[model samples]
Target: MAKEMQKTSMFIERNPGDCENGDICKNLDDDGRVKRTGTWVTASAHIITAVIGSGVLSLAWAIAQLGWVAGPAVLMAFSFITYFTSTLLADCYRAPDPVHGKRNYTYMDVVRAYLGGRKVQLCGLAQYVNLLGVTIGYTITASISMVAVKRSNCFHKHGHHVKCQTSNNPFMVIFACIQIVLSQIPNFHNLSWLSIIAAIMSFAYSSIGLGLSIAKVAGGEHARTTLTGVTVGVDVSGSEKIWRTFQAIGDIAFAYAYSTVLVEIQDTIKSSPPENKSMKRATTLGVSTTTIFYVLCGLVGYAAFGNEAPGNFLTGFGFYEPFWLIDFANICIAIHLIGAYQVFAQPLFGFI
Candidate 1:
């Protein structure tokens, strides 16, 4: 047993402090080292965190813009594309064994190793943009959720646009503060609990939002909307229609922009046993689950609000019903997004 423990220590990550949870290990490699510590569950959380973010809050709005038939069609297409691209990415984690079993540690490594041109720089640029966009999106969403809960008059009349008295900036600043402390924990493996919690919160709010929408629709609270979904409230003519339609497509595209972490999160899985299959499984499970959630949210939100759906479904789910449920839903959103920021940012931090 002592000899086995000693052998294991060679590969085990040396954490900053003793792990409080026997299984959860938060550690860092001082010299940009990747540790193989994550299980399939942990990898799934990271993937889920990457795939589902603040963009989900706008899916219903996207559906409203694209109409029902087109909206769902686009989502299904994106799902298939993301799944294929994800698997292709997982296969890139390692090189042919003849090359001394070399591995591509970051997404940039793969680009530089294989593409070897101006494309490397472009990949880096895109990665930074993705990281920045994801971080900003989560930070903003978290702040909005916090604001929805803190303010008393968040929900009032259905047709009335209720505004929160408190500034969202303060809440964002507070999130940053909390994040700085949380970010100190270095290892992705250590955040297993956090990832699990985020996943649960995601399911929680999605279920609540869907359930309420169904109830409202069944109770005749909402008018029957067309299959195409909602409207952008713009005159349908010339480039105006074309531009907005494309813009809505771009919005849906943003929802699935989770490719940034493919290599890094896959790096967390053990290279033995399941081998190349670890990330494939994670991608399939995570993306599949998120797609279901997205469809439900988009359908339910559009059903309730039709053409009137706002840009953010969470804040605009329903004002009058049980206001507390809205608050609860937002609370879940805020918590999930906080973890999401770390999941997306960790890869950037690793690469840099």
Candidate 2:
């Protein structure tokens, strides 16, 4: 019986594209689809791209308007707020079973589940509004920064804001549109390397500009007046007692305003495997990195200017000067923001 065993054996072999049920699995074959493998660095890069954008550049302006201590405090406060929102989403949201599986309920799903349909619609609309405002702000800031870099113009040449020239210069619109279009193209795979390079460029650029600002301020015979009065709009009027009280709360508002993305980030990481500790670790590192960077930029900008008022930091400190790196940073930021817009817009697109 042992000698005859090989004569009775039958073997079944499956091809690479075959399924266990003996079906040819064509579902994965050239369906205009691509798959990407993401490790910790890729995940971190994506999250960082979400968090750090055109907003960081405006930190100096916001903090200047609010106060010096208010800037870094805002960053820390926003970080925690975002973290808490993310945690809440992780605990409350649930996905349907695979047998009748639906795409997992996103943050919008949780909002709709808790708040109902009408509120969800309203919230979605509000998010679009926020996105629009954010986009416009970024585009304007980037274009202006581009001008400042290329023309060696003043950072805040109030008489000739760079955005004002766009109507006459068709090339600027063409370039901006091209950048926007490039951002919209789906090439999510293999972008981890691109993001890593961008992040490095961001750090290097900020470091050099910040260093120069610090040096000039240190050697200063104080070219600009050290700001004292809390200016409202363009007015240099002294801060009123009531306004000063309000200014104390300014950082909290700014911090919370930017905390909205935390929900999206939380949903993303929570979708990963339970055993994968790296997602959480990456998130923590990303938030910490952003916090440290913002704090350093804010503190240095404030100290160099010697003012508690936010605007004072920019002008009084002379630290917001046009550096070559700002141009590069703006482009990187625009690209990074395009990724973010894609992520945020996908759910809405699906619902529509």
Candidate 3:
């Protein structure tokens, strides 16, 4: 064993980039893999892209069901839980010694490193399943946004009374084709540009929604709202109210569900300043930003439409006179989901 150790030390001295396990050394990082150039900014962009998605579109409806008290409360609660857990998961990017230990390229790798055995397999299954569901959800949401854009244009041309119906199948096919091309991207490190663009798109649509809600409130066209949310008897039956409340809570929780990819995002950050530290900061910034947007969109949308808020303010035609702006927002949603689909799908691709 001493002789083996001596030989290993000699080899390491001669080839500093080489590892005992014969991992790749060319263009390698300290961990004998491709060098990481991601900073907290890019990681934050990735987090934003992943976290603030179609889920944000449903916040107004969620708030309507949850009411004034439980709506914002649930949103804040989920945001805190997501940020707290993400910071912990970020530290798991590297095992043994977080700063200098072996890097776990994917979440499952982290699972294997620290919680080896059947648990690794179980975690991997769960991770992939979750990722798959997210991608599917993004696909459907993107298609809906596309359909909304077309439907908005039709409404503008034909008048509000017209049906203006549009099919989602073609839009879904188009989204799938786009993904096929984007999937060709080599890996996560190469996705900073896409994430940045998607992050911007998320902001664009969210801002538009907020602006529209504010306009409605300013115009004094606010819908009926209560402190507790939709009325138990008038808006919905007691049992129905209970079910809707739970669904709203689920929607709020889903809005903050980016922990599945937290470690992968951390893996992309530079080693300097310590990845865990950088990731924690990124998590805070990303989640805080998302929470602020969620608060504005959810609360303002609820204030504007109250119990009558559509499932999606933009796509649901909550604002009709500014047809062009609504079209732009829906288009932005489609663009954002296009990139988000890849963010959530990449891990599954890598795992396979």
Candidate 4:
């Protein structure tokens, strides 16, 4: 009997997955880590939270620069490119064989598995640097949104003519404090709630922006818009127009810049349906959803403000009458960025 017990223990140690009666093994996944509870829905939430960031707020300005002809075209082009590359990246979540092979936990892990040596280090360096930049950008954007909220209220109480100037330092400090607390979250697997909240906030603000643009267009207030975008010498100087056009393209590209965190997001998905298959479906759903929002926001915003669209319609002081709605939209932007900051920052935190 003792010999049989010892053999059972050895079997359990050698094959953890086969240990049906063991609590520890039952709690763990095939990879010997804590079980992953994420589904494609949660994965889509994370992707949406990461993809539709503060960058979406600038799509109006992007479309304004490119105008009717190239604006929609560029948006669609980037959408396709992002979706295509993301599907390919999803397949790389597992090495050699996506389903049965060993898991690659992060983007850097994926790189290390497929292309070892110096390439891994290079990928890590680039990825972390990009993540750092994105976090910094989110910090600034969140502060700006917070400041916009305050300024919107001030303008409503005072007058639009009043400067209502407010310092971003205090807001920045507040945003930093919030991030410091949220940064305590251990990993992507534990961030589903935050991502879901952030995803909701993203939709709230985006929908508000779209609604506002539709209202503005319906009110019959039209600004000049050319098929080729802002006129060369009339609306802007030759050099200014060229630079603005390039910057607009950059903004559109940046709006689809969540690919950096794709592998990390994929790591949280369960392995039953296969991680790659789940990730691909989530990617398709998330990107398709965002593309629809992007097209609506960009085109409708341009139609509302024409070539004179502000960089960010919410904070750019484009609509002033419905001040409460504007304030709420800005607040939503701030809330969304709070979670987004972590989504991008966790990979860097894990690496460290």
TM-score of candidate 2 to 2 decimals:
0.65
The C-alpha local distance difference test score for the whole of candidate 3 amounts to: 0.88
The weakest ten consecutive residues by lDDT in model 2 span 27-36
TM-scores of the candidates in the order shown? 0.83, 0.65, 0.93, 0.94
lDDT of 1 by residue, 217-284 (tens): 78887654666553334424455556767888998787887788777776677655443587888888
Question: Cα lDDT of all candidates, in order?
Answer: 0.75, 0.48, 0.88, 0.89
Give one digit per residue, the lDDT tens place, for model 3 in 189-233. 789999999999999999999998899999988589998989988
Q: Which is the better candidate, 1 or 3, if ranked by TM-score?
A: 3
Q: Write the per-residue lDDT of candidate 2 for residues 79-188, one digit (tens) a residue.
A: 78765654444444343332222322355665676687689888877776665665555455445444434432344454334433323144356446755664543334
Report the alpha-carbon TM-score of model 4 versus the true structure.
0.94
Give per-residue lDDT, candidate 3, residue 178. Answer: 96
Ranking by lDDT: 4, 3, 1, 2
Worst 10 residues of 3 by lDDT: 6-15
In candidate 1 the C-alpha lDDT for residue 154 amounts to 43
Residue pairs whose backbone atoms clash in candidate 1: 67-228, 68-228, 68-229
Ranking by TM-score: 4, 3, 1, 2
How much is the lDDT of residue 157 in candidate 4? 94
What 10-residue stretch in candidate 4 is worst by lDDT?
5-14
Candidate with the greatest lDDT versus the true structure: 4
